[model samples]
Target: MKERIMSKDLMNKIDALGAQEYMSDAQLAVFEEHLRGEHERLIVRQQEITNTSMKNPESISGDEADKANAIQSSADARAESEKNKAMLRSVSVALQAIKTRDYGYCIKCGEEIGLKRMISQPAACRDIECETLEERKNKQNPAANLKIS
Candidate 1:
């Protein structure tokens, strides 16, 4: 049947993508391992931030300037943690896409994402054109940062 043939073709495509020579499977594996380690590190860092409250305004019991600096530093750390969390979410989505045979395809336009881009960014969900548009939109309106994958 046509459906059966299409399914087999899809399987073949997936197999080809997974092949070691052309797709940078080994590099992706290394990048994934590095990402996992970074995720763990960020979790530990977040925990440390949560545990450290002496710098908070309520607990500072110190000079006003020092308290202000502490608050600013704490805020910066929280922002960094949030960025890390976002990146982790992107990585998680990329991993799931790989498992679902949806990797290497632009989530937005469905074009084949370049292998070089994929190697450079194992979590990429968009080709350059789509990604550029998304970035421009996000820069213009932060709230419009649509989840790609």
Candidate 2:
């Protein structure tokens, strides 16, 4: 059987739990501020990389080594930009979850994810057990990483 709560009771429960048991309003605000800062920084960095020089002055004289070095630098910057983009998405999703009253619960097990874990990684979606299992699976099937998506 399912239980029902009165609106007032539900509100009280929400207040007591603070929507997310582990996350407080102040903490959310702080995290949001940091996330926005990081997002902006990454966005700016990726844009800056787009405008970066493809060759140094020495490379302008047709030096193969300098040309190769410039290519490597561009590739590394692009890789970093991709990494930052992923993190930015995670932060955006975390902020949305915080706003939508789903921030502290584990997506895999529906358990309270705990204050420490949420504080340490605001973008976490699963509990430690689920994450560990996922890691084990990833290690066991390294070929999965090589598959073209």
Which candidate ranks first by lDDT, i.e. highest? 1
What is candidate 2's lDDT per residue for 1-149, written digit by digit as tens?
11123223333433555545255675566556655665677678767766673445345555788767767887787777677678878877877877887776787888877755655565777788888988899899988767375
lDDT by residue for model 1 (23-53), tens? 3555455545544655676677667766763
Task: State TM-scores per candidate.
Answer: 0.67, 0.68
lDDT at residue 148 of model 2 (Cα atoms): 75
Top candidate by TM-score: 2
lDDT of candidates 1 onward, in order: 0.68, 0.66
Clash count per candidate: 0, 0
Minimal lDDT window, size 10, model 2: 1-10
- What candidate 1 gets wrong by more than 4 Å, as runs, is 1-35, 53-55, 145-149
Cα displacement (Å) at residue 60, model 1: 0.7
